[model samples]
Target chain A: MDVQVYRVPMQRLIQGNGMPQESDHGVAIVGMGIVCSIGDNIVEFKESLKKGVSGITRLADRKGPKLSVDIGAEIKAFSFLDRLYRYSDIPETLLQKARHCAQRSPFAIQASVLSALEAWQDSGMVARENDPERLGVIVAGESTTQNYRYGLHAGFETDPEYLSPRYALQFLDTHQVGVLSEILTIKGEGFVVGGASASGNVGIIKAVQLIQAGIVDTCLVAGVVADLSPIELQGFVNVGAMVRGNEFQTPEQASRPFDEQHAGFVFGQASACVILQSCDVATERNATVRSTILGAAMNLDAVSTTAPSASGEARAMNEALRRGGVCASGVDYLNAHGSSSPLGDATEVEAIKQVFGDHVSKLRVNSTKGLTGHCLYSAGVVELIASVLQMEGEFIHPNKNLENPIDHKLRFSGARFEKARIALAMSNSFGFGGINSSIVFQNAC
Target chain B: MEKENIFSVVKEAIADVLPDVDTEAVSIEQNLKSLGANSIDRTEIVMSSMEKLGIKLPLVSFGGVENIEEMVDILVDA
Candidate 1:
């Protein structure tokens, strides 16, 4: 018998980041499903990328102040309700439409179901109803549109005098997970994460921990956001987050990350889900292994609610790499949280310099938000999907609107796809409350 | 107002909110809740309908309508 140990490097190590040690967990991603402005599924999304086609478009009859960048990466043809009923063998019109509801019931339920079903099918895992407790579901969502808006409309139309109670009770955010669990028949460990932009990464990280700790054999991690209501839209506008622009010209050019003339971010809705299991379990089950979750770290800025500290971001990246048993040199590319905002982009660049130091010069960095227009809660998983695709295809997707490298030390893939065998890729996602998350994926050969 | 004008206004509002619903099936007597118009959606419909009709009803007035027909009655009375 031979004992073989794989030693991953640690060139620039940082201490006490509260990250789990590499020995404590071994999580692997067997399957992924993504629905975004790029495509409805992974295959279509890949095809669109190969053809250099973008899913961005100008919204029709949109009401707002005219913006210089009015383009968005939106999935227009996807009907959650139609697809759900079609695929699930559930008949349409079976679910009655509640009175005065803004959204259809079937549509809302289908959003989660479609993504989850795709992940399950991709993983080649069959749902065993007999042992339902083995399957766990953790969904991340920003809004409870289905439950809240529906109840509000029903109450206002049926009885206006008792409106406050209905609005308060029905709009509870937990309904997103409840509805999803009911539809999927997932019986174990149901939770919902709602930490602004970090929700997707947070959900997936938690799911990985659960499976790694022997709590669940399989976990369904999903992030979703439905239509942006006027109230929500106005709120973003008030915070100076939404970029009101008409000159986005084309959808592909709308989100210009790391560009000198870049404006704010556009709100986009999407859902991305992945199936995670131990590598041993996946091999036994004959799952199509996509990538490995080598290491993940989550931290808070501890500075402000809205602004993230560069030190915090650096600590997160360093800690994630340490947990993954990799070094700064081992990291091949970075899928950045580049929201196209001036301060956010600069802060991330400084963090990369602080963490990676000299190796930052060798790091290939690109932000998929340039293509997807920041899907908010779904952004992290969607970007992770892009990273996995890059790893599988042995290529780094280009950052569309980056005309000039903001930091010469950082290597920008620069507007065209580049061929590279990425052994380790990292993704960073930071949210409004200084919630920062960094996840590293290794090419599982 | 002519019945045709009322139907057109209601149809447009419905189309905006519930684009998937069959326009031909919609009528004054149809149960709005059963048809999938929940309270928030109905409010949007009402708001859009009022915009089209150029009529403004007090927010308190919407309390009386139980379904689409009752909503139509309120509109007719207004």
Candidate 2:
């Protein structure tokens, strides 16, 4: 009595160039929006990426005992109502709905609403109006209410009975899904997905799958801001995962990914959103396709620790390229998950080498985290937007503080911008707990 | 505290909870729901009014509360 194991051939699994056949619907990114330390909207964000602006700075609203990590790229001077009203093109009814729903909500919820509205507006869906039942919302975050909860502890400790009733609803992470869906009137499937630091990529990948599966014609993926409380900041500092900015002359220099003196990641805050629609629907509505999502892949290393795994990351990249029907040589740019952690940077370099051996010499590489300060949960989405902006502009952003490269073989961007045309690019995001994700995008134009 | 004073405190709480409401135009005969207060908003207003008056009562104490006058009467009795 013997048993034999069978395996399916790889060629059958992969069709031409890894893309869905002409009969199948392809996913297209028709709109993008963001609210980060560097920019409050797509236009401003694109400009910041072009100039390689660094948003890291000394924390202005720090509370509790002084931690070793006192500086980060926090969204400063934030007023939710002010940002909400700035979208002048949005109809008054929608603005009123947003204000009523999120005016009294936490910072994280308000940021997500703003970014989602921007993406909705950019997609022209605001005016064209697809069936609400055909739309879906995917929130990319977990434990997003840390700061809001931390702020309530003092009052709660003194008088638990007097806690605001709204706390019961606002404290949950899925509250973002509820608030965004209410404001945008999305009625299809909606849920939250988290993958530690790779949460944004996870959310995007899920949205693309939903569109491809025909469950929805359009999906909105919102990456919530990682509004870590002071305690979380201290936790990262104690675990040696975040940098103490006092060592640098200025806060802007604290996040230097792939540099010889790289230490740990500097925390950043951002809420990003992208509207993904099937190519058939987008073309039918005559929506402008910002980029086509050729493929996306996510895998776990079966470990729960915070250590990085090169093989896992390499597998994700290779699988993404294969699923997209793309060859290693076809990729012109690599938006790396260079979170400024020494080990993280080194591990990603090894993964890139494994995935693109000879192509590493010609493939231009840069880390958006060097400028955005590692937007934690939203870093993947933020970097995806950054890559598209660079591709559209036909230029590569400078690796702001890369004075000394860790590995000389890789073509890391210099201290200044470089002009290059990128028709196709790959973005990688690796998270704690062995979560690895990679996404491939091709310029739609 | 007089009933009128308690009513003003409750009115202030209502104003704080419902930003769009015109408290000056509010009448004691009006209920919170009519003034656009959801269940949460109504609970928040009650808690806030109690806190401002330096009183502690179980939320159930206001279980049968209907109008602004009835809520003010309960605070007046306290």
Residues A1-445 of candidate 2: C-alpha lDDT, one tens digit per residue? 1111121233332355755433233489998999998999998988888888999988985556777788899888999988888999999999999998998899999999999999999999999756999899999988999999998888889888888889989988888999999998999999999999999999999998888766888999999999999999999988889999988899999999999989899999999999999998999989999999877999999998999999999999988887777777788999999999999999999999999999899899999998889898898899999999998889999998999999988999988889988888999998989999999888888
Candidate 1 residue-wise lDDT, A196-256, digit = tens: 8888888888887787666777788888755564556656767777676554655556577
TM-score of 2: 0.95
Interface root-mean-square deviation, each candidate: 7.5, 0.9
Supply the TM-score for candidate 1.
0.75
lDDT for position A138 in model 2: 95
Native-referenced Cα lDDT, model 1? 0.71
Worst 10 residues of 2 chain A by lDDT: A1-10
